[model samples]
Target: MFNESKKAMTAISQYCGNRVDYVQGGGGNTSYKFNDKLMAIKASGYTLADVQPEQGYVTVDYSKISRKYDEISKKMDIDVEAETLLINLDCVELLHGMKDLRPSVEVGFHSYLQKAVIHTHSVYSNLLCCSDEGRDNAKSIFENSKYGYIYIPFISPGYTLSIRVKDEVIAYKAENGKMPDLIFMESHGMIASNDDYETAIEIHETANQMMIDYFNSVEFPKAIIKKTSKGFSSKTEMINKFIVDFSADENYFDTVNIYPDQIVYLQNNLGKTILIDKDNASIEYIMSEKQAQTLEEVLLGVVYIITEIKRNELSLKLLCKEGEDFIRNWESEKYRASLVND
Candidate 1:
């Protein structure tokens, strides 16, 4: 089963990497468990398409980590002491030895799953997660689906997310007498699994298609842009403010650039409603075709914005449903290598 599962992992990785809507660059991870003793997972910083059975895949001993943590905690009297002991336990050494690769931050979540786990940052899933309305829309789509779906709110990756997933899975099993077939992370993506490789892959693909179908059914309101030079500076300022508020990262600062689409979007509708006082001199307008196009793409697209702050790489990604325009956009097609140069 282990060897077969390894092959399945490689196949799934390739499938995900090949589909830009499913994964881009190093955005997703996959795993398979042979038994209580060993599990293989995709390595960090590697695309699924290039992963070979022996290269990007890593095998680690799960029993060792679990046993070591359990043993150390039982011997410790204080919770603080137990946590400190667990962090420094030899289990860390064992993890480090697993191809010297950093395991997925969601490793704990995978450990609790069955023989195989496929975590993908699919565009459709992200689109559904980003908006409050989108979440409800997704729930409605899967209301009567055969596969169990669980939605978990966004949490920063690492131990916090891993522990939350573990607890949620446990709670779900206790309540329903079964584990969910898929876990949807709000503002993130999804984790899916099954005993059979084909079944797991099918579930993921079908679920994504369902969401895409739902998104396509939505009638987007047309954006009407109004031209005004006085409003441009003010609109840019407002956009900058919105970006800062949304990200709350100092690194963004004044470096945020409002492209032509954004300018058109703001000058059209927002400029009318928002008052332009001295302190709030920013002009507002409605959405523009370009902005609408961009927003539509963002809702249905997989975008990764790589920024450099003080020479360090800062990549901000928005994984959402790919809009029709985006799919047909020459620039986007080129980026995905879906179009050939003449």
Candidate 2:
């Protein structure tokens, strides 16, 4: 039994890590519940494709997480500001050799899930999640299908999103008599959780293909991921030119952000030579080696996600000013971005 899960973990890591389409940057996470008292989850800032035993995941205390979540979440419901909740989040305990490691912020929902969980930033799945009519379309498609799923509208990642997910799962079970095996997080990606790794991966695959087929039938634009980044163009002139050409709209700030991680990956780091001052409605060209590489790494994702949005011609969902401010200020997110930047 232990060996099966171990092999599953390694396979899961390799499968996800080897594909940027399934997992990008430091986004996406995986977990396995060891028992009622403990669980092993992908540590923050690590990729699923390259995990190495306990080195890749931190085993957390479920009992401690559950207790603190209840406490902090209850206060979050009453408190208007999110600061106190952030401080209280530290209450969730890490076990054994994992104390120094940071757990994925999704631990709340993972703790409430099955023995195995696999979440991905699959681009094909995002074809549906990022669609304008995605929720209604998903309902029409999966409502009576054999696979059970719940459509959650865009929620910023972290305690708040998990709180909603926990409640949604509870309500789904009450209505459908089963844990939602497939959860489509609108404007984000898909999440699959089940008693075993294969079950989880299979569910994601099924839903991902369903989304792919659905979008394909509509004659969706081709997925244009550049498989190799070894020869990516980092010339300041080229980077600035693309920024001006692609992100020149007057409403750029209001509409350009497509994912929270984009902020983590690009917000402060992108366009060292080109800067967007939101309040001033301006773009400036500066210079830096760190900035060039940072922009190169995250620039493609930004361009692609936005390009997909335009291709669909669907009323899009962009990160709001408040949401952007919140995520950019987060020290944890900054740290995660630094891992990639390093």
Candidate 3:
């Protein structure tokens, strides 16, 4: 058990760490089911990189959560959000070494998956996911894979998304006699899961490579930073070019968001902390050093997705207006965004 926990912690950090831009700030989660009932998942407000062998994750009775969803999911009168919050809290195990932390909000879906699961907002996956032609493109791109993939249409996050995913997985399993290794959520991100950690990692990396090779995408560029009186400015050519190309369009920022994490980090900062320095062909953010860096990564990610979509001559499938409004008003996302500075 101890060794499994340590391995899970290490695997979580690898996806969230510097080796790959799989996630930014507190945007993604990883989980490992220790047994039929107990599962370890990243805490709600902590980035995956903060997870360690003894802290930054929580153990939950995943079977209980899964059962509760099955029982209540089909009922029409339940207050899903409130019920889900209560159920999640109740399922948390008061374990010895685990921190007293709230599990990631997407735990509902995690409980339904295999032993090892990684959910990331990868730029490579989003290149196909955030485009209007993404669904068809995904079908064509991954058609020959040994392990088939599942593409989920855009669904609001939280319990609802979990339910949707559960249904899809159930349907897929019925036909294929097993779970899919890769699940792609449109306008969101991807999930790679397997019974073991190493295989799960391989599935994720291979899926990312497939997309990158298909589009011939260059490596995502790093932010070129310079100190400013209030905060920091990005001199990255790609980021600057994006601002220059779309600064005249009033709706560009709102429409350019291809994933939920982008809105979580950038929505509040825009026009306040984040500013366009068109004169210098740079992007500026008025915040502390830590906050500035966090925002820079997210902004760079957004621009990277846009540039890739444009470069491939693909039509962008942006988040709808309603989805943007929901994310802006979501308290859970607001809490996660707040952790960026801490």
Candidate with top TM-score is: 3
TM value for model 1: 0.59
List TM-score per model, in order: 0.59, 0.78, 0.94
Ranking by lDDT: 3, 2, 1
Instruction: Put down candidate 3 lDDT per residue, 150-219, tens digits, no spaces.
Output: 9998888888889898889999999999999989999888999999888888888888898889999988
User: Which candidate do you rate higher for TM-score, 2 or 3?
Assistant: 3
**Residue-wise lDDT of candidate 1 within 43-143, one digit each (tens)?**
54455676776667666665664444445436646553334224323333233323565454345567677677888877567665544455566578887
Winner on lDDT (1 vs 3): 3
> In candidate 3, residue 23 scores what lDDT?
80
lDDT of 2 by residue, 238-331 (tens): 2344456665432453347766776676555344534554333334424334434444434444455555555667566666677778787876
Clashing pairs in 2: 13-49, 17-49, 273-286
Model 2 TM-score is: 0.78
Off by over 4 Å in 3: 74-78, 248-251
Evaluate model 1: give its lDDT.
0.52
Each prediction's Cα lDDT score?
A: 0.52, 0.64, 0.81
lDDT of 2 at 231: 24
